[model samples]
Target: MYVAVKGGEAAIDNAHRLLADRRRGDRDVPALGLDQIVEQLALAVDRVMAEGSLYDRELAALAIRQARGDMIEAIFLVRAYRTTLPRFGYARPADTGAMLIERRVSATYKDLPGGQLLGPTFDYTHRLLDPQLAGDAPVAAPATREADTRAMPRVSEILTREGLIEGDGALPDDREPGDITREAPEFPMERDLRLQSLARGDEGFLLALAYSTQRGYARSHPFVGEIRIGELDIELDVPELPFPVPLGRIRVTECQMVNQFQGSAKAPPQFTRGYGLVFGQSERKAMAMALCDRALRAGEFGEDVTAPAQDEEFVIAHADNVQATGFVEHLKLPHYVDFQAELDLVRRMRAEAEAHTATPVKVAGKAAE
Candidate 1:
């Protein structure tokens, strides 16, 4: 059959136009609004915001729509947009102790000072899909009696109160943070690199890695000290008070993992920490992240580490999806040029092999014998 293969520029331009048309959909149908996406696909927005490292709901909603609900694409979009934003002052660390908590749970304790509040979760729900969701649903409110905002101490606080558990404050300050982005990771990294890996690491990958550790990769037994969802105060550096000034509030999920620790000669036994903080109600990711964080701290604990999650170099190296995707997709851009070079090399090697076969080598000792 006769065929024509030509016009690369026109083909690419046509493809781009078609993509725009498909993304926009029919002319009769109105473009999906940001509010609609935000209201309907909140969880997607949450994931985008968490992964994108940005907190603007509107921006996140826009990214979700623009990326067509592909979370990684949404994250890429947000990150790209984020780079264009003006550099602002960094916010000081948010305080969890003073958080206006919505959901608080502790696996370590049955009952604690601050009672567990199961705010919004799918944990105990039956997996069966409901047909009633087709209609507009009524907004459900918490029971009036259960809405009290009483100040409550953490479950771990009781352990500290009785001197039963050793906190992170007990750890020696000899170890320093390793910067993963600025420098390449080396063996025997510090806690900072591990935390950074867990922070940006793929949720599923980190979960599996964390699971492997619990499934007997690492010897430490991790107890979820506290899983808290709340509004934490964002403070900014102000020269006036010599302290961080409270700027605003942002909702976050903070998971503090308390792992068993044995005392060494230099330091007394205490509960070493693995902390995970994420935007929104991503408790599972936070918990998984915390576990992975603890696993990665194996080197710091002076233990024989053999877990995939514990390899700081490997874990941190593969954690960022942005880096991973860029390297993986760059292969799609014009490798025919490289293929031609490789083809030339292979042809030359074949020609040399044919020449060598045609010219037989001398059999010296055997012929003489």
Candidate 2:
């Protein structure tokens, strides 16, 4: 039996060459530009940024191109690059309440303070692919309307007016964000840590967990109180500078989920909140994150934590797609020593069983004689 391993430096080199060729595709065809990926495939870029935990669209676009549009791989590339970046002083968290919203909508309210700006969305479009887009087609005249530049108010504020929503009552100045990347997610994580993890967590994984909660695994009746996709300023207060320096605007998606809760002896019943804010305009990811966030807070509301999403430890541990992928794919690598040990144990067990059976048969035959 000849099973020769073909992996070596030469094979690896060849593989890389082939990958480069494949990525570029046909030479006659126009190669994808980084700018094109960032502008045209904006949603894909958004996913990479959100999951990569990096805000730079240019870097994310480059990663996507290098990864051959494999989003998970692109995320891995970005996260790896992020580790090499020097840490400047942390900027104050962008205020979402004062965000220059591009798209703002609410499922809980018919009309919000800032009228809903439908912005660029696929929600109303038919799913069928237009043949005209096969080649570059001239862009049609865009529909024009008076831009709704109104400063949007958070929907939770309306509910809060009547004491219908639950909030920590702490002012914004009283809080600080914890970095999940710097520290391991120990049990009983702070709300900041939880949000940090969920924001960068695998979108599909979060979506499934959220779906589970909706299907009665951990029933938290959630309504999209408000979903706003916008750009917010990142400001750093440099000691040398007279005022905070503007670090430019970042596109982000923020979701606030209003869930039904009942009062226990400790507190009065009010609508509880689950929130999600991601690095890019990813409404689906944000919404799913919000749902899962509420599920993880089951214990806070005195609810039983039976579902997978409700268990904070489990969710956080498996939320990182990069980590999960590494753990799973590593099984395909050389496990020769581990498998050999298992094979030896199994062979010994089978021999012992066979001998025991023969001895029993021999003893029975002798007794009959």
| Residue 128, candidate 2: alpha-carbon lDDT | 94
Question: Which runs of model 1 end up more than 4 angstroms from their true locations?
Answer: 1-8, 26-30, 137-142, 146-148, 169-189, 239-245, 266-269, 353-369
Give the TM-score of each candidate. 0.84, 0.92
In order, what lDDT does every prediction score? 0.77, 0.88
Q: Please give, for residues 265-333, the per-residue lDDT of candidate 1 as tens digits.
A: 976677767788888778888998888887777776788878787877777777777777889988997
Q: Which 10 residues in a row give candidate 2 its minimum summed lDDT?
A: 358-367
Compute the lDDT for candidate 2.
0.88
Error of 1 at 331 (Å): 1.7
Report clash pairs, candidate 1. Answer: none
Residue runs of model 2 more than 4 Å from their true location after superposition: 1-7, 168-176, 359-369
